[model samples]
Target chain A: MTSIINVSNLSKTYEGGFQALKSVNLEIKDGEIFALLGPNGAGKTTLISIICGLVNASEGSVTVGGFDIIRDYRQTRALIGLVPQELTTEAFETVRQNVSFTRGLFGKPKNPDLIEKILRDLSLWDKKDERIMNLSGGMKRRLLIAKALSHEPQILFLDEPTAGVDVELRKDMWNVVRDLQTSGVTIILTTHYIEEAEEMADRVGIITGGEIVLVEGKEALMNKLGSKQLTLDLLTPLEKIPESLIAHDLRLDNGGTNLVYTYDSKSDRTGITSLLNDLSANGVKFTDLKTNQSSLEDIFVDLVKQSS
Target chain B: MNLRAIKAIYLFEMSRTMRTLAQSLISPVVSTILYFVVFGSAIGSRIQEIDGVGYGTFIVPGLIMLTVLTQSMSNASFGIYFPRFIGTIYEVLSAPISHLEVIVGYVGAAATKSTILGLIILITAGFFVDLQIAHPFYMFLFLILTSVTFSLFGFIIGIWADNFEKLQIIPLLVITPLTFLGGSFYSVSMLPPFWQTVTLFNPILYLVSGFRWSFFENADVSVGVSLSMIALFLMICVLIVWWIFKTGYRLKD
Candidate 1:
């Protein structure tokens, strides 16, 4: 995929000298769901804010669709939509009016059909006439999304999209994001929810301390660093792992009734077969065995810990 | 120029006035009527005329100026302030529209509303007094100029303000006093020489003098100077707004 957004050596320092972003460089591919995973205060919001023009970068530059964000702001901004982390809407305005208002602000002609479709897709059609102040928190969040999509921007930035949402709403949001990607919209989402990234991202970028430590295909990232564990349910309890199997560094669990062996799942040979043969040779018999692989959450936790 | 974007913001702001129609239209009308009864009828009975115009009719322009100036400032200030306070201003900052377009949208709506209110007050004053227009063209001109200028000033106050209290403070402490002392209730010519010189320093005096001159050919200053004062104020406001957008002031922190 071609790069749709280029952020080169971007940095942002607030008036109070808080450095929110530090020399960050990122390229967002066209029509891909790129999830930016970071801990709180990791500058996820700052990075997107600069690209979207909500905040100014202290150094470096950003280009959206080959247009400089500062020099060609109008063109770049016209191509993007942003759902900010905060739930903000005109409290007195009805849902339909607010969304239509946003579309107009983006310099788009009024498109009632398109607005209706977005409302329906977001399950907000029935409540289109309701004042935003009266809507539930979840509905308000959905209205924000509707406003962002009003102009049919080619790129969407969802900053902490699912921060306080329920599981059902999160699922619905994921589906909406997926549909947008299918329609050729490039999506960049900033999330601390590791499972959210696992569920929706095509590519994952790990950011910590204002720097991107890694960016790779989600599958490749998981497979490259992912580890698997083999567990043996022994026929009888053993106080300790046998001397012959000490080299494998096995772990005992459930009062020594279970034995666990860890290995790299993607390595040429999991070293499992030899371990099994050694278990037999040492008379470490087991009634049953099950292998388990670590989740993306594990990989993410380790990466963040290492960076910190 | 993003005319559609400007139109959108204009309509959105106008709709807010519509939602509070009674407050926006009724309050000013009521205040004008009460001022007529108290100052025009009761006071005019004791005193005859300010110049050639009757006491009741003399205050029409001043009354309208008072409301328009205050209304324009308030409408414009709150129009932009509410969005920033609510955090929805992020969309505006992120939108493809230019800063000039934003100023046009917000200040345009505010000025339009106040101009409409000024006219409504003019019509309302007609019921209480016999009003005359010496220069009908200049009447509308001064009315629009005052509204647009103050609206721009109010736009600045809205952006400069960090909190709700700060928003009310400028208009209340700075503007309200100036409007009253600017010869809105009494002509500057009636004041003693020293007091008249002090009143000359109030910028609003130019606006009131010009607007009233349009109605009765009577004024505290020449119509040219009055026009110049309004133009100068407008230019200052325009510069402040330009600086606000240029520096990203309180909006982009």
Candidate 2:
């Protein structure tokens, strides 16, 4: 598969010696939802700003669809849509005007049919004639998406698209994103919400301290780094772990009401049978047992902490 | 620069400016009337005609220019400054619009406002004093030139201003004082040699004198010199605005 975005040795050092982005390399394939997850000031916005040509890169080369972001700015920018984090639209302008004007800015001729499709897809068709300031926050977020998609860009950069929005609005935005992906538009989103990535992203990238620590397929990352925990509700409380159960690496919890056994989910054998046998052999019995898998949030937190 | 985008931005800005029709259009007209009442009628009663024109008529061009200058300056400054204040400037910067398009849209709107106020003041000054139009063509030229020039200057002020206070500083401190001392209500020939020479350095003096000369057949200062000075001042303002847009001073950083 051809990479739509190729970033190499990207670093940004603002004036006054504040280093915002370290040397980072990343490649996002076309028609995929790639999520960049990070803590605040972890260089997520900075990276997006550099890619969108909002801020100058101190040292790096970024190409969108084989065109340099700085050299072929007009062409590269024409192909990319940037939805900034701030809700910065003309308050006095109607929603239709706002979106159409954005398309015109890209030197695109007026296409009313495409605009109607975008507005309807984002659930903003009914509010098209209303002033932007009159719309609620959720409607405004959806309008931002409509504006970004108005020009039919190949690559879309949504910087915290759902930040501070209600859950309903977030779901609406996600649906719009999925629709775009189905239409073969590559999306790069930076978000603090882990569930958003877990629900939508095909590939995940973790940025920490101005560096991209890791990037991998979502399922593969889970299978590779994910852990499984087997918890047993003991029939009786135990003062301590018996000598025979020590080899199983079982943790006693809830005053011996629960016993946890951690194992690699990817391993062919979970060793659960042997662990149960060992626990029973030590005169311990369980009334019920349940197994749980590590979530993306756990993995993300671990990756960020390890890099720091 | 896309013409469509420029038109869209221009129309959008103009609509917002016109929304407050009462404040935007009325305030300047009212203030101009006050200027005519206080400076023209009251002050002219004690002064003699200069260069064969009534004192009231002599000050008419200056008062009109003053209204245009201040209105142009405020309109341009506020147009750019408000976007920054409300964090909407980022929307403009992030859009695919070029810098030239942005400036054209904003400066065009500011010029339109100044021109409107100038015409209003001209119409209103007729009620206070009898005005002359020795060269209506030059009069129109001067009005347009002054409007465009001051609007450009105000565009620079908008870009350099860091806050609301900074936005008001240029018009309040610099443009206002210069207009007062630019031989607005009197002829430069009446002043002493030193003061006359000193007034020559003020750019507003050139604009006012040029505009006033357009109305008088034979004014103290020759119309040719006044036109040349206004042209020179306008060029300087354009260069300053163009440089700011090119270098992205206080904009890109």
Candidate 3:
């Protein structure tokens, strides 16, 4: 896939000498959901702000759809939509007015039909005439999304879109994001929720300490670092692991009623059969067995720990 | 020029004015009428005249100037400050519109509101006193200039201020005092000679004098100096606004 956004050697240092982003480079593929996962103050918002032209970078350059962000701000910004992390709407303005005004800000002519569709899609049609301040927090967030999508931008940046959202609203927002992706809009979102990144991202970029530590396809990254844990229910309680089972990465759990073996799932030799044979030989019998695969959360924690 | 963007911002701000008509329009007019009641009627009967114009009539331009200056600054400052406070400024900053267009939209709306308020007060002033305009065109010219100039000043204050208290500082502590001392209630010529020279240093004196001149064709300073001072101040404000946008000071991190 062709890249829609290109960033090279980007760095940002604020007035007080705090470096928020450092030599960070990234490329977002066209029409793909790319999740930027990072801890707070890891420069995720800073990165998004710079690309959206709300904040200036201290150094480096960024281009969206072959146009430099600074040199061609209008042209580049016209193609981008940003739903900021903060739930900020014109409190006194009606929902429809806020959305329509945002479209006009992009120099798009008034199109009530388009605005209506976006509002309906976001489930904000019923509340279109209500003042924003009167809406519930979830409804307000949806309004922000409607405003962002009012101009039908090619690229949408959702900064912590689901932050502070309830489970139902988060699920709704995820569906909204997925629907946008199906319509061929490239999405770049920053999130601390590992499950959100796991569920929505085609690719994941892990950032820490003002740097892009790793960027990889979600499936590939998981498989590369994923480990499987095989839990064996003991026929009888054991005080400790048998000497023969010591060679395997095994641990006793559940008050010695379970013996758990951990092994790389991607490895050619899991040695499950050999481990089973040794277990029987050592007089350790299992009544039942189950395996658990490591999740994206584990890998994320590992990456952050290693990088820091 | 992104006229659509400008119109969008302008309409949004204008609608806000409409929604708060009681505070934005009614309050100022009511206060000005009160001024005409106390100063125009009570003082006018006693003093009769100052600078050869009726006491009531002489203070009309100055009263309008007081309201115009304060209204322009407060309106424009609050116009931009609220967005920053609520974090909606991100939408405008991230939009395809240029900084100049953003300024034109906000400052233009503010100046329009203040100018309307000034004209409304002018019309209302006519009810209490026999007001005469020697130069109607210059009167309007001064009105527009003062509105636009101080609106720009307020825009700068909006960007510079980070809190509600900071936003009110310049208007209350600086602009309001300067306008009062700038001879809004009385003529500087009536003051002793030393004080007249001292009053010349007040920047608002030029705005008040220039506006008052357009009314009676009489002023403490030459019309040329007043006009030059206003034009120079306008240019300085424009330059400062340009610098703010160029450097992204307070607007960008």
* Candidate that scores best on DockQ: 3
What does candidate 3 score on TM?
0.92
**Which pairs in model 1 have colliding backbones?**
none
| lDDT computed for candidate 1 | 0.92
Q: What is candidate 1's lDDT per residue for B1-253, written digit by digit as tens?
A: 8899999999999999999999999999999999999999998778778887888898899899999999999999999999999999999999998999999999999999999999999999999999889999999999999999999999999998889998999889998999999988888888899999999899999999999999989889999999999999999999999998887898887
True contacts kept of each: 0.91, 0.33, 0.90
TM-score of each: 0.92, 0.87, 0.92
lDDT for model 2, please. 0.84
- How does candidate 3 score on lDDT? 0.92
For all candidates in order, the CA lDDT equals 0.92, 0.84, 0.92
State which candidate, 2 or 3, has the greater TM-score. 3
Residue pairs whose backbone atoms clash in candidate 2: none
Q: Which parts of model 2 have CA positions greater than 4 angstroms off? A: A229-268, A274-292, B217-247
Using lDDT as the measure, name the better of candidate 2 and candidate 3. 3
lDDT of candidate 1 at residue B122, scale 0 to 100:
98
**Which regions in candidate 1 have their CA more than 4 angstroms from the true location?**
A229-262, A266-268, A275-294
Error of 2 at B73 (Å): 1.4
Q: Mind giving the per-residue lDDT tens digits that candidate 2 earns over B136-166?
A: 9988998988888888888888888988899
Error of 3 at A35 (Å): 0.8
